[model samples]
Target chain A: MKGMTIIVKTISSWVKVLIFLFGIYIVLFGHLTPGGGFAGGVILASSYVLLMLAYGREFAEENLSLPVASKLDSVGALLFAAVALCGLCCGAAGFFFNFIQQRWFAGQDRAFDLVSAGTIPLSNIAIGLKVGASLFLIILVLSMFRPDTSTNEKE
Target chain B: MSVPLPVFVAVPLVTAFLLPIFGKKGKSAATFLANIATIALLVLAIASIGQSNVYKIGKWPIPLGINLVYDGLSSLMLLVISVVSAAAMFFSIRYMEQYTAKAKYLSLFLLMVAGMNGVVLSGDIFNLFVFLEIASLSSYALVGFGCQHEELEASFKYMVLGSIASVFILFGVALVYGNTGSLNMAYISQAIQKSGLNAGLGFALGLFITGFGLKAALVPFHAWLPDAHPSAPAPISAMLSGVLIKALGVYTLARVLFNVFGVTIPIGWILVVLGILSMVAGAFLAIGQWDFKRLLAYSSISQLGYITLGIGLGALIIARAGKDITAEQLAWASLAILGGLFHLANHAVYKSLLFLTSGSVEMATGTRQLKHLGGLAEKMPVTRATCTVASASIAGIPPFSGFWSKLILVIAAIQAGFYWVAAIIVFVSLCTLIMYLKVQRYVFLGELPENLQQTKENKGSMLVAMVFLACLCVLMGLLLVPGLRETILTPAVNVLTGGYSYSADVIKAAGGM
Candidate 1:
């Protein structure tokens, strides 16, 4: 597929980075704000989607290849699960116990800080990475199907 | 002994995500890792048996935070899911070799297992739905893994219907939350017990029945099963028929209806009627199928019918007798529940064995059409023998697992004063026998076809998996022995019989927080 018009491509190229940065902000500050990993992930994916729309599939694939995205997806999920498993070893606190919050802050003193919620930000980051890569891959794979022009032309 | 409940969901889940990183060159490594995960799960499930605990996630108290409830029923279900998954994973070691992207297949397989474990252990209704989606989405992908025309078509149909079921379930959950202000099962049950079944709650119950019934593929909601089950590869066929439906569909229905909402007369009869309908319809449909796996798939519906019938009969007895019920009625009710739970375990074993046998046959002969293959008894001795054992168990032949459960159901029906129910039970058994006889005749006993002349038995892990389940099919009847029954089956039965007290019991188990 050919690339879109110059204006569209230019605007998307400029806007995509901002979207990515905004997504990172949402993920990092997810504990205090409404937008968390999933929302941030969508924003991140949409940034790529915009690039794909403007530059075409090949350009986007060149930027973030399929294999890399796939690996990133797995890594993100593993990171989340690894974080959860870490809680299992922490002195009978149970799975997903927020041990860092309890040990460092002692009660709800750090409730309003950026890194206040123990493990939440980390989990959100992992989930954000997974959701972003997964959505990108889904859209990329779905876009692979094109009309069979030769068959249609023959008919 | 204190195997953490989260481990059941975590091991498979982490392994699922981890497998994809191995890529193409690491197929063998991925498979090995996946096998270890499932085996570890099976070991954990065994160790955790006869012990119950409520693990509050993040150590949050019940009613306010998510909890994983491990009780008699969950333990039983976890054991079944682990056994079938372990067998299926082992079988996939060789069986999935024909397909490309074996790592992805294994990943999806583990994902499905993780989802099922989550569903079984989840104490919160909405969390159960999330896990249900995870399992359903993966199974949908697995069903279409072949990516052939028919496989894709079947997967689409399955996904559409399954999504509809999920939507219904989610809507029901929302209604329940709106009505009771809680997503936790224990809290919801308590609220219902306190307020009785209001109109909204009753409607939510209706939605749950429709949703889970669709998931379970009970008669009216069974259009997707035959197509979806046979289209997948054999190990998947086994997993789908063996544990997926029971874990996602029937188990949820039983838990919600019996434990959460508290069974009433109308609801009890609704379940009984649905069970009977599924039994008669599924058996009749199955007997006519020429496709080996399709026949088994239809028979799965029939077998599931027997389970629902047992549970429904128990519910009806309890509902009719009510609080002033006599000891005899209570005994009958417990017997019915015992039959249902026992049949659930028995079916998971034999049905998965049956599907694995079919897979072996399909692999060896390149066809699942019964008519194209015959006289495999000579060529594939192991597959033939194991298939016969599974068929016998499923047909309720004496001394096998199926017989004991069927006997219990019949006795319960008769003692509960439902002679017609007993008759139908016998009738279904007869129909099941005929179907398997047809399978035996067409697939094993007849003249060897020219095309299938060079067929050979599948060996190694596939054979081992088949033989493992076949042995379980034969020995599962021992689970009914008085001493053994006290440990597994009785506690499960007590959970259902306990009814409204489930909330109290769960909260108490959670340290009364």
Candidate 2:
């Protein structure tokens, strides 16, 4: 299906990229600020959703495609889990998340810096990627069943 | 050796993400990895048996940090979850081959396993709710995996009810945090003791019973089980019926009621009434169903009732006790709880085994309706044999696992002067016997349907899975015998019977308050 009016498409094309960049900022600074993986991820998903609404389905598929989104979703979750597992190698800290903040690697002196908060920022970025990929996939799949105009069957 | 508790949840979560990466082509490798994860959990669970520890996340102290507490009850639940998951995953290796998205299926399976492990190992209320939602969501998707008309309808029904239950639990957790000013269960227990039940705390407990009770499918809240359990693929049916309800519903309910709230007479009576109602109503409803898996689903509610009844009886005795309580009464209460926990373990094995056999039957003949199946004893001999063993076990026949547990329950009821409860218990066993006999007569004995004539026994991993559980059915009697009881059943019972000791146990394991 073709997209909306030329004016809406032109504005969305510009605005969506800005939304995408803001989402990255939220995820990267999750530990320092209130916005974390979940907030950042939703923002990221919305940016792509805005593109799909402004441009047609065909245009969006040509960019990221389905397989790439699916693979990226899995990669994000795996990355998050891998960060958590890295804590297991750092002595008797518990399982799901035990980041290494002390032991000579990442010092506590520079707590406010981007590299601080042990694994929280890394976890946030991974979660942001996962949430963005998953939400986009859900939207894309739902869009496919929306009465394909070229076909005759009543989807 | 004390296996790191986080490994239980981590291995599955990691593998769940990794398996989906295999995508469409590497299905065999995906299944292999999934099986390895479940098996490793089972081995770790075995090693962690009878071992108790508290691991503080990031080494943070209690009341501030989330600590995973491994205790008697946690280990028992861990043992049950791992055993059934390992068996179910093995069975799914071949059984799920017919489904198109095999990799996605395996990933979802691992996700469900991770969620359950988290539920089992979690030491706080909020994290429990999080893990509970993860497991429930994946299960809802898995139930509709076939994408058939019935499966979709059933999945939607299950999801609506399940989401409501989750909301109730979350609300209760919010109220708990608000009232007690803590999220850690041990701290909450201590706070509740220091300040008795206020209005908010009482309301929270009410929400908990309703939420967990709905998840467990106790009578009035059981509208979804009949449709949902039978709609899923067989292995999933086994997982839901065998362990999901227990870990999500019974375990949490028991933990909160006894440990956090500290059982009172009113709560004890409520549990008793719910137990009896579920038993009688479930049995009555089950005896009339012709769908093989549907019949088994109703039977699950009924069997769960017996466990609840035993626990309730024990709780009643405990709550009624004064400072000078009699030794005999204490013994009776302990016996009741022991019966309940024993039945829980036995039922997990036999019930999952029964579902697997039913799956084999369905796979062979392409239907689960009893009227449509007959004389499978001649064609699928192994499935028929395993089905018979499971049937006898569930019906409380002597020498099977169910008989021993029910016997303990009856003896405890009679000893405690609950003659009517004892009578009802015996009467229900007869009802159970009649239901399974119906299953045997219609599905295995009567004239074979012409469509099912070509049906043959399922081979490979399916057979291995069924045979392993069938052996367990015959051997579970040894669990109640004198020596083994000390290690297995006693610790679990002690956790409940110890009652107030839970707070101290947690504090001590965490290296002090």
Candidate 3:
């Protein structure tokens, strides 16, 4: 598919970074806020979707690419699993036990702090990455099935 | 013996994510890793045969956090799932070679396995729904993995129906939670026992039955099974029919009904009616199918009917006896449950084995239509022998596994004074036998087709997988022996027959925190 109008392209390129940063903010502060991994991740993916709509499929793909997105997807899942496994292995607390909260952040007044919720924030980051990459990949793959009218028009 | 319950889910879940990273060139390595994951699950399931434990996720107490409750029924289901999965994975090693993107197939396969394990082990209602969706979604994708026109259509149909079933289940979960103020199954049961079933909870129960019934493909809700099961690749078809319906449908239904709702006469009779309808309809419809896999799919619906009938009969008796359940009544009820649970395990082995044989035949002869094939008993000796074994087992022939389970169901039906039910069970068995007879005569015993004269047996892993399950079919009846029965089957029966006592057991096992 071809790019949209130049105005749309110019506007999206500027707005995309802010949107991505906002997603990161939501993810990092997820443990304290209502919007956590899933919500934040969708926002992250939406930034990329914006770019795809403006600059077209090829440019969007060149920015993140299918392979990189796929790899990131797998990596995100592995990171989440790794965090859970660490909890299982490190402490006698059980699978998904918050070792970081118990051992490192035990006692004291870290409750409202940004770094307080132990594995929760880490898990949020992992889920954010996974959801972001997964949504991107899904849209990219679905875009591949778009009708070939653009190529035909060129011909 | 008390293996951590999460390992059952974790091993496969971790491996599934790790797999696709291997990409195209790493297909063999990915398959090897996937096989190892399934075999590990099998070993763990075997070690956990007679054990029960409750693992609380995140070290949280019951009612506050999700728990994995591994009891007799879970153990039994786990064993069946792992055995079938292990064999199916082995079979897929060679069978899935026909398809491209082998890594993605293996990944989806493991994810389905993980989801099933989670479903069987989950102690919380919402947790169960999440896992149920996981398993159902993967199966839908796998069904259309080949991307053929027919396969895609079947997958779409399956997906739409399955999503509706899931929505119904989620609504039920929400109702139960809203009424009881808890998502933990044990707490919900205890609350129900105390407050009893109000109108809302009663509605939830109905929703649960309809939802799980759809998942189980029980007669009225069984429109998707024939197309979906046949359209998938053979090993997947085996897994879908053999264990997926049992784990996601019947097992969850039984868990929710007996353990949570605590079984009333109305519900019991409802189950009986559904069971009888499925048995009669599935059998009549299956007898006329031309496609081999489609025939097996319909037969799966029929065999599943036997399990539902057995469980429903037991529930009816127990509900009738009420608080004054006598020794004899309890015996009859447990016997019926035994038959159902035993049939469940037996069906898992033989049905999957039968599907594998169909795969073998298809791989060799390039057709699943019985009309184009004949007299393969001469050429493919091993496939014929194993197929005969599975067929005999499924047809309720004596000394094979299916006979014992059927015998138990018949005896229980007679003892409980449900003579009509007993008659129907026997009649279905006869119909099952006739269908298999047609399969044998047309596919193996008749004159070989001209083009299929050079057809050869599938060697290596596929043969190994078929033989493994075939051996299990012959020996599974031994599980009914007194010593083995006490360990493996009896506990599962007790869990169902014990009714609301499940809450007491799970809470106590959770250390009453």
Task: Write down the TM-score of every candidate.
Answer: 0.98, 0.97, 0.98
| Candidate 2 lDDT, B1-513, residue by residue in tens | 878878888889989999878878898999999999999999999888878888776567887888887888888888999999999999999999888998898899889999999998888889889999989999999999999999999999999999999999999999999998999998899999899899998999999999999899988899999999999999999999999999999999998998888888999899999999999999999999989999999999999999999999999999999445688888899999999989999899999998999999888888998988888888888888898999999999999999999999999999988999999999999999999999888888989888887888899999999999999999999988888888788888888887777887898888756
Error of 3 at B482 (Å): 1.1
Q: Give a tens-digit lDDT track for model 1, residues B209-235.
A: 999999999999999999999999999
Clashing pairs in 2: none
Model 3 per-residue lDDT at A69: 92
Predictions: Cα RMSD each: 1.2, 1.9, 1.9
lDDT (Cα atoms) of all candidates against the true structure: 0.94, 0.90, 0.94
Q: List the lowest-lDDT window of 10 residues for candidate 2 chain B.
A: B322-331
**Where does model 1 exceed 4 Å of error?**
A107-109
> Top DockQ: which candidate number?
1
Pairs of residues at least 3 apart in sequence or in different chains that clash in candidate 1: none
List the candidate 2 regions with Cα displacement exceeding 4 Å: A96-99, A105-108, A147-155
